[model samples]
Target: MKTLLEAHNLSKLYGNGRSQVVALKDVSISLFPGECLALMGPSGSGKSTLLSILGLIIRPTSGCVLVQGKPVEEDERSRARLRNEFFGYIHQEFAVIENETVEKNVMIPLQYARIKPSRQERQSRILQLLKQLNLDWAVHKNVSFLSGGERQRVAIARAIINHPSVILADEPTAALDRKSAEEIMGFVLSMRDQGCSVLIATHDERIAKTCDRVLHLVDGRLL
Candidate 1:
């Protein structure tokens, strides 16, 4: 399989000297197209920090990330472009703009990716994505009016709008009921089956078991 994302001997440090916190120490991971990988650990085990680095949102203090064998430098402009083009993130909080309409939120990625779509084209695709998640009815509503499940669906649609090669989800199902969690996982698994590499940072064993592989994060090292 082709590697979609790779972290080479990565480590992240915060602060300086004696007060510095080592978030990730010599951690390396890779995600390939069409596979799902899960990272399981308790709080502060460096799962989210690792995902941030792989997504190119946060730079690693040491080591490098490569996309298709090219090293990702600490170029803000370039990294932002790579993030829009290559990775999709689903935060634990489902970070949607509360004041924005669902459709507007979904279109954010298209803008970031510099994809110029005709108004109709953009509307059509966003509607289609919302419809897929049974969210078409909520398309015009502000995200603040939606329930937890609805918000997550909107987040999912937006994350996938660019058809990203890799997706990093942090505790994707932690806030949902079992059925809702399963429903969300169903969509994520479908994405994997359709060739999107997925990396999930979660503490739920049941969720981890659904993936192609599950690795534990203990003291910043994969177990």
Candidate 2:
């Protein structure tokens, strides 16, 4: 029951003076390994903003973030290394390179990590992930040619290529139909079972029911 990630008094503010807005207000959350947490709320509820902070895509205005019980430093060099080594993020947008082939898109993270797998090994891993997400048939297709769901699956593959300790997902199933959404939720559940903590920012009621815990966020704080 060790914690995988923790946020203490985390907050984010945008703009300044009269136009300043508080995106997150001293929100705190702790996630343990093997747990799937659904961060649920209506629009402008700060779910995505919270996810971005958790994934290290953005820094909190104040407070501390810890991964695996270790405090994170504010140094840019350290943050970048930690993000590359310990976390996976599936953003709301597919974020895949439209000009690249699906395989290449998925392999981009691995290459960035300087993981020199054999061509066969890389292809095998990509195929396995594609199969898991029901997108193996699009393995060789150009990213631009695939539908949104397919692109999202590719993005998921890319995020998970490193087998990260934590996965942060923002509206991961927004582009999928009901059946596909369920399939994706099941995949996330399996990740939790494997001891990789999963944090999802989603408004999908159906998907929320699949998580071990549902945190309701209102305005900028957990409700």
Model 1 misplaced stretches (Cα beyond 4 Å): none
lDDT of 2 by residue, 30-101 (tens): 998888899999999899889889888899999889988989888887888778778989878778999989
> Each prediction's Cα lDDT score?
0.89, 0.86
Candidate 2 lDDT trough over 10 residues, lowest sum: 108-117
RMSD of 2: 1.6
Model 1 error, position 118 (Å)? 1.5
What does the lDDT come to for candidate 2?
A: 0.86
Please give, for residues 59-156, the per-residue lDDT of candidate 1 as tens digits. 88889999977888676988998888788899878999999999999999887667678878889999998888999999999999998878998899
Error of 2 at 4 (Å): 0.5
Q: List the pairs of residues colliding in candidate 2.
A: none
Candidate 2 matches the true fold with a TM-score of 0.93
Scored against the true structure, residue 118 in model 2 reaches a CA lDDT of: 82
Model 2, runs deviating above 4 Å: 114-120
Candidate achieving the largest TM-score: 1
